[model samples]
Target: MDDIKRKYVIPGDVITTGPYRAEENVNLVGDKIIATTVGISEIYDSGVRVIPLTGMYVPRIDDFIIGIVKSHTSLSWELDMRSCYPGILPAQDVFGRDFNPKVDELTSRLKKGDLVAARIANFDRSRDPLITIGDRDLGKIEEGELVKISPSKVPRLIGKRGSMIQTIENATKALITIGQNGYIVVSCEEPEGLLKALDAIRMIDEQAHVPNLTEKIQEMLGSNSE
Candidate 1:
């Protein structure tokens, strides 16, 4: 099967299957199984299926994320995540208690101008991503510098089950938090470590197809140190 036929079909591409039938395939990109003819047909072209370029953020449930706290009420906090709509993180969701604390107490816990790591709890028909901090691991970020990238680039940064993040952490001695919306938070004791972490992330964003990226990063760091 050709990559285009197997993965996705672009506009103006000719696909045929039915007896003496030819149809121009339109722009369709995804994991959807497209039928070329009434009966299943084999793909003629083979290549990597690439999604068309677009500027949009599609929110998913339970995605680990980072956002800045914009405003806070007695119950919830508003966050600015550079999306079509702002996200909301409620106090009960984060604190796990119904007892409303004083303004100062709440500030001490999670205040305005603070960066937090949370999870997507739900979304309304408007597609506004609602965040939560009910879990132990999902809560206020203790430390880190927030970095932003295109939401589409998250898959490349995460790699497989944190393999990429762990590799960078080990090499540069920096802690990293990757958000589904393409926000990165890096933390390290030394400025040099933070710089190394930033450089490694930029490299991954630029060259995602390269295998063994962790090893390549190590080599680059070693040469620079010398």
Candidate 2:
């Protein structure tokens, strides 16, 4: 954990000799806990966990995200989620309405260029990442301007209990939806509002690790408002 804390660690790096509660992105080899994936470890009194700094979005259970439909097969749709591999959005995972490839045109319901907001249903190493859009909040996005940022900065952009995002929303009066995989959508009637929200998101992504990030964003917004 010491080596992992100060510097970067690669896969198979021995994380701990003692019994450790293995957290995200790690594996166990013999009696030692090893890093299965590349990430940094944060050791707390209770346990040690990995925080990935760089890598594509590895879909985990229940991760809400936005994806662009790339192609669709007879059974499912392939989505580009900024990952090494595309995610699968099965017809069964669609909201109350289901499209049938046998009879109807799948592209009509969800075209190749359409943007969807969904959640990671399952992600097996052997299988393509599965996503579900059954929830009320999950569905097709008709209109919005999109932006991309580093996924690692998502938690910070959201802030404590969603304070950071709320600030940007209130200030800009734009409807903003964030995807854990780094895609963000902002919709507003006024073009100025959309630009402001995009600017705020840029600031958050670039300066998330800095101290008083929320305050800095607030001041920036204040001056811009003036």
Candidate 3:
């Protein structure tokens, strides 16, 4: 409810009170909420989330992400979601409506080397991640340059309320789509602006923790303009 979240926290730290909703890698014991991960404690409008400074992608339900569709058979579609384990986009999950996988061309839905914007529907340690694209925001992604960075750096790439990504888009005159899994797609007409945007993203990924990152990014953009 309140944006009054503790910016930085470590394991065993009390991030908030028990009355608040607790996210994954966090525990609500008694009247206090405790952190189980070493990362920044962020309380959003909906709930609280701890962005781990270092860790592999742990698929969570409703996490909007982009993945490269690697393979698919009659039963399942596999995706490379920048995690050690490949995610599974089940036919049942994507075709719960009138659509039938058997009747449709598989490649039309997803193919090898194709990028898709989807959401994690289910995840279990022993099983592969299950994803879905029923939502409007989730679908096949095309015509954008892909940029991969550390999964931990995703939040920094998207500043508070999307200020950071917007800054890059405005300066480069490009449309950038950022996934929570650290996959970014930047589409620009001008090669010069595209390179500048890539450089800015790399800079953000490298120096995310430093203060004045926004100002520094502005400086870089200004120099390019001049």
Candidate 4:
């Protein structure tokens, strides 16, 4: 509940104690809340959770994610969510509510191997996560270079106050779309700038835990005379 400082921690490290609720990747032991993974720990309001350093992507409701269409049935399409469970996008989500499977051909919109920007509409342990791309910002991605990174490192890529991502964008003039599931799409007018931006992103993913990373990224971007 207090303003606990954030810190890097491994499994068994005590994040804090008190009446804080254990959120994720943390365990409640006696009066101490201990981490259950190697990651950064933080306390907010009355909850304590660990942002894991490495792990599979876990779909959470309302999470905006980029998914690859893997397959489809007559009723819905299955997407690779980069998790154990596939994302289900129902036919009605893409078509109107009056959609008829027999009349509305599924492949008329999206087919396998297509990339889509979607949001998790529903999820639980018992059922696969459901995703929807009906919103204004959600749909098939037609252009941009795809880049992947560890899902856990997404927050680090975003940085405090968007400093890290802003740096890369300003330096390279590249547009980057980040997915909570670790999928990224980058677009730039200049080919050289595109490569530079990707290199910077990869650097961040590999060395996120390294201190003074903001400064290091600045240096890397500035080193290019082009």
Highest TM-score against the true fold, candidate: 4
Q: How close is candidate 3 to the true structure, as a TM-score?
A: 0.76
Alpha-carbon local distance difference test for all models: 0.68, 0.83, 0.84, 0.93
Candidate 3 clash pair list: none
- Model 3 lDDT tens row, 1-226: 5555657888899888746788767888897888888888887764677878877776777888889989998867899999888988877666665657668666666789999899988888778888888788778887889998888898788898989888988999988888888888888999989999999999998888899999999999989999
Best by lDDT: 4
Q: Once superposed on the true structure, which residue ranges of model 4 sit more than 4 Å away at CA?
A: 1-3, 14-20, 43-47
| Ranking of models by lDDT | 4, 3, 2, 1
Which stretches of candidate 1 lie above 4 Å from their native place?
1-54, 101-108, 209-216
The positional error of residue 216 in candidate 2, measured at the CA in angstroms, is: 0.6
TM-score of every candidate relative to the true structure? 0.71, 0.83, 0.76, 0.90
Q: By the TM-score metric, which is better: model 1 or model 4?
A: 4
Worst 10 residues of 2 by lDDT: 1-10
lDDT of 2 by residue, 129-188 (tens): 888898888989989998998887788889989999999999889999999999999998
RMSD of each: 6.9, 3.7, 4.3, 2.3
Please write out the lDDT profile of model 4 over residues 167-195, one tens digit for every residue: 99999999999999999999999999999
Q: List the residue pairs that clash in candidate 2.
A: none
Q: How close is candidate 2 to the true structure, as a TM-score?
A: 0.83
**In order, how many clashes per candidate?**
4, 0, 0, 0
TM-score quality measure for candidate 1: 0.71
